[model samples]
Target: MMKTILLIVTNIEQYASGHLKTGLWLSELTHIYHAAKEKGWKITIASPKGGNTPIDPESLKPLVLDGISKSYYENPVFMNELAQTKSLDMVKNDSFDCIYLAGGHATMYDFPDNTTLQEILRDQYESNKMVAAICHGVGGLLNVRLSDGEYMIKGKAVTGFDWFEETLARRKNEVPFNLEAALKERNVHYRKAFIPMTSNVVVDGSLITGQNPFSSKEMAKVVVSELEKQAFM
Candidate 1:
């Protein structure tokens, strides 16, 4: 059977201050999407609320935009997918082999407290399927609780956009809360790269996470590798 992936992105398009435009980080979705596509897996893009998803302007900057992400940015079909994502309520959680949270600073405002998102994650996780996130996307994992009432990520090794990386990005004070601290408070064995903004990935059984935007490609590689392993087993 072909594996399917459910990608969850935030709907918020700006900062709480309303001065900065922020939404899904383009590379986070592109890297993972292409990785899975290369393996001939199905991909579905969805959001907390079904509608157009905004892109973080900073992600489109020339210095940061990679070839793959840039190509998708210029592709009308791919851009249309972002403009018409399925709402969480419209998705069936049990159908996907994996559920991924794609991050942008906007995710900090929307991903954590979404009840529907939490439910989908809880279902996918409790069912023993893959749950993955990258950068601030890991914020979605903060509030997900299994049936026993434990945070799904509790005691599992994980990583996300670290506080220092926020400082490096010059948004340490702009973000709503400290993501690294939140993950630690949940008691997950959180880890990060020694050098900021570099690739760092953690795999704890079925939960896979990447430390920052730069980690997306490598993280997706790991996700595909693991899923391929599970498919054959």
Candidate 2:
């Protein structure tokens, strides 16, 4: 049987006061989707509420939109899949071999405090399934706790969109809370790139994280590599 992976997208529009930017960063999902497809892995997309994932207008910029991402945006079948994403309530806990959370500013609103998502991550982590997240999607992992009552990311070396990057993006005051500060308060071994908003990917055990949008492709590559290694192990 082919391995299956689940990708979660954000549904909120405005996170704090600025634009929330829903849906997965196009490159984020495309990179992983194509890689997993090459490996014969089936990929499924889901959202908190499901149905009609809205694309971030800024991500559609020519500079940011690559061929794969552009094609994904134009593909009817892919767009339909994104439109009718599976609901978290309907998905079985162990149906997938891995779970990936794609990032966007909108994720800060819905990814955190989602009990259903928390359950999914908890189940995947306990099952030793690959659990990966990129950019703001890492916010989803913020509240997930293992069966033993331990925080999933506690003491784990992780990286996500840092405060400095947020400041540079002019969204520092818009987000619900400072993710880096929240992670640090939880005792997570947080790390970041030397420069603000640079590509930084971290793999601590089965948990993989990427710093920002630039790191999405690399993050997906790392996840696919890890999954391949685990398959042969």
> Best TM-score goes to which candidate?
1
Local accuracy of candidate 2 as per-residue lDDT tens digits, 1-233: 47899989877665555444544567877788878888888888899998766777767889888888888889999889988988788775547888999888788888889999999999998888888998889999999999889899999999988998888878786778888888787789999999887789999988999999888778878888888788788
Clashing pairs in model 2, backbone N/Cα/C closer than 3 A: 13-20, 14-20, 20-106
For each candidate, what TM-score against the reference? Answer: 0.98, 0.94
lDDT of 1 by residue, 66-106 (tens): 99999999999999999999999999544899999999999
> After superposition on all CA atoms, what RMSD does each candidate show versus the true structure?
0.9, 1.6
Evaluated at residue 5, the lDDT of candidate 2 is 93
CA deviation > 4 Å runs, candidate 1? none
Once all C-alphas are superposed, what RMSD does model 2 give against the true structure?
Answer: 1.6
Off by over 4 Å in 2: 16-23
Lowest-lDDT window of 10 residues in candidate 1?
Answer: 89-98
- Count clashing pairs, candidate 1: 0
